[model samples]
Target chain A: MSTPSKTLGDYVLGLADDALVSAQRMGWWISRAPQLEEDLALANIGLDQLGQARTLLSYAGQLEGDGRTEDDLAYLRDEREFRNVWLVERAQSDFGVTMARLLLFAAWQSELYAALASCPDPTLAGVAGKAVKEVAYHLDHAARWVVRLGDGTEESHQRMQAALDAEWPYLDELFRPVEGAVVDPASLHPLVLARIEPVVAEATLEVPQVAPARGGGRAGLHTEELGYLLAEMQHLHRSHPGATW
Target chain B: MRDWPLWEVFVRSRRGLSHVHVGSLHAPDAEMALRNARDVYTRRQEGVSLWVVPAAEIVASDPGERDAFFDPADDKVYRHPTFYNVPEGVEHL
Candidate 1:
């Protein structure tokens, strides 16, 4: 492949990191979701995110023209060195919160990937084309959960609303535009909102007017939770350098 | 969560193919059950379409009636496709 501009590389890197971090978080739900079926569902969704991470990471590495492999990009980086939004990094111990974060994140990804699917960059376009379908499923799954919990019993409705409120702050981070990206992130915000609003409405949930969190993940700045997550994710690689089955 | 009803899943591998019973999963409603079936049964390109029916709705015949219901047909060799003569130039019969 001819040399890709660093701008494109950085944009794809952000996308890769987004999928990678979200995969790590989603993996936490396996065997831990409310039901066994839900566990399998989350595991499948997590695997999808992991698959996207691998493909995008490899492409991002190529664009950077650096010798770093996907493994190097994942295992060797410090928390601040990563570029995923805080939406996927923070602790989501509550299942409702997990679904809420997923709904927001996947909605943005749905729009972002759809826009990127037809971009001039063939590699990015190819990746986005595949990812758009995967994210569509993710969005649907999340929306289902959000609707079920939010419109169910009073206790569940309260909890789901609270989850949405908690996740709202991180929503802004997703729309911060990155240079050299196929689509302007800012441009996809309204489309993402349109995808999310109907789901929220049907769930009988409100989109809270909470202030946006201070987000610098695109600049390699991350939340305190990311450090803990990175410790777990990077530990195995650091302990057994270059070892693989 | 315990209130979620169990749904029997059926998957059609492709168009023009009959849906085969796969397995069962618990879901709150038919829409969610279809999504759950997509995740549980069709994750590996296993099917193009899915059907989810509430487990309570299926009226399965009693196993105790196995002899009365199926044994009578066993001795009727004429009813079996196995008695058909082998035709040349044909396969997968």
Candidate 2:
């Protein structure tokens, strides 16, 4: 494990990476959604998450005191260099599966940001405060769908449960502490877990009874899926270096 | 497959204001209705609060009654405060 930087800069980058990758994955579904309204909804959510990623990444870059900007980090990073969890990199399987992932991710992020809002650093605090509100709405959006699908018709219920089962293993990777990570899991775990468990239980989904995947995000190791994600996301930038919008 | 019902959305930009009607969308139920409303109507940060009502539930005044219901009020000069005397110290009427 590499020695962790205690600075908020390093920690914020981790958070930003998580949002950035998830946003990219969600954005991939723009015209591919099963329905038109859903296409718009996912796109909107993707934009919101991207907005958050931009804010956090820009702040992280500034705090690092390196010459890198948000665009530099977002456009230039290699697949192995990104620190997002594997769950976010996985392809969207179906609407139900996407909702399941969104529910889990949003619930965790909302709690994480709520706690982060009280951090000693004012910039971190302010960012978290703003982000928490957005994430709360996102969680509500996902939670309501979970309940609707869980309690709906036989087909919906079955699909919802299957979605839960399929995504359950990935949940563990979210909370697994990054070795020598700047953020203290000891301090943040209770707060994040307390908020996540009840929501999962309420959805009538079984929490993962299995061991966590040997998560390697912070170590810059990633699932095979990430390479494809990076290829699609960075293709424009990599092909035409320094191309402007 | 049956399509979801259409819903009308209203959003309040902030507190102490009525939710002004924005647009309409289709959703499975009230929960999804609200979510759809938020995503479609409030993407530009134009709202701080949202209200979703089924398009079927809203009882709007008849357009044919516009003259009978609203035009009459325009002629009622007593309702206007323009004729009322205002104290000099009053900052707002």
Best by lDDT: 1
Candidate 1 residue lDDT tens string, B1-93: 799999999999999999999999999889989988988899889999999999999999999999899988877887777877797989887
The 10 consecutive residues of candidate 1 chain A with the worst lDDT sum are: A1-10
Which of the numbered candidates is closest to the native, going by highest DockQ? 1
lDDT of 2 at A114: 76
Best by TM-score: 1
Q: How is the predicted docking of candidate 2 categorized under the CAPRI scheme?
A: medium
Return the TM-score for each candidate structure.
0.94, 0.83
Q: Can you give the lDDT of residue A9 in candidate 1?
A: 80
Q: Write the per-residue lDDT of candidate 2 for residues B1-93, one digit (tens) a residue.
A: 147788899999988989998888888888877877877887788899999999999889999989889987887898877887787898855
Model 1 over residues A83-171: C-alpha lDDT tens digits?
A: 89899999888999999999999999899889989988888888889999999999999998999899999999999999999999999
Model 1 chain A, TM-score vs. native = 0.97
DockQ for all candidate structures vs. native = 0.85, 0.50
In model 1, what is the error at residue A130, expressed in angstroms? 0.6
lDDT of residue A192 for candidate 2: 58
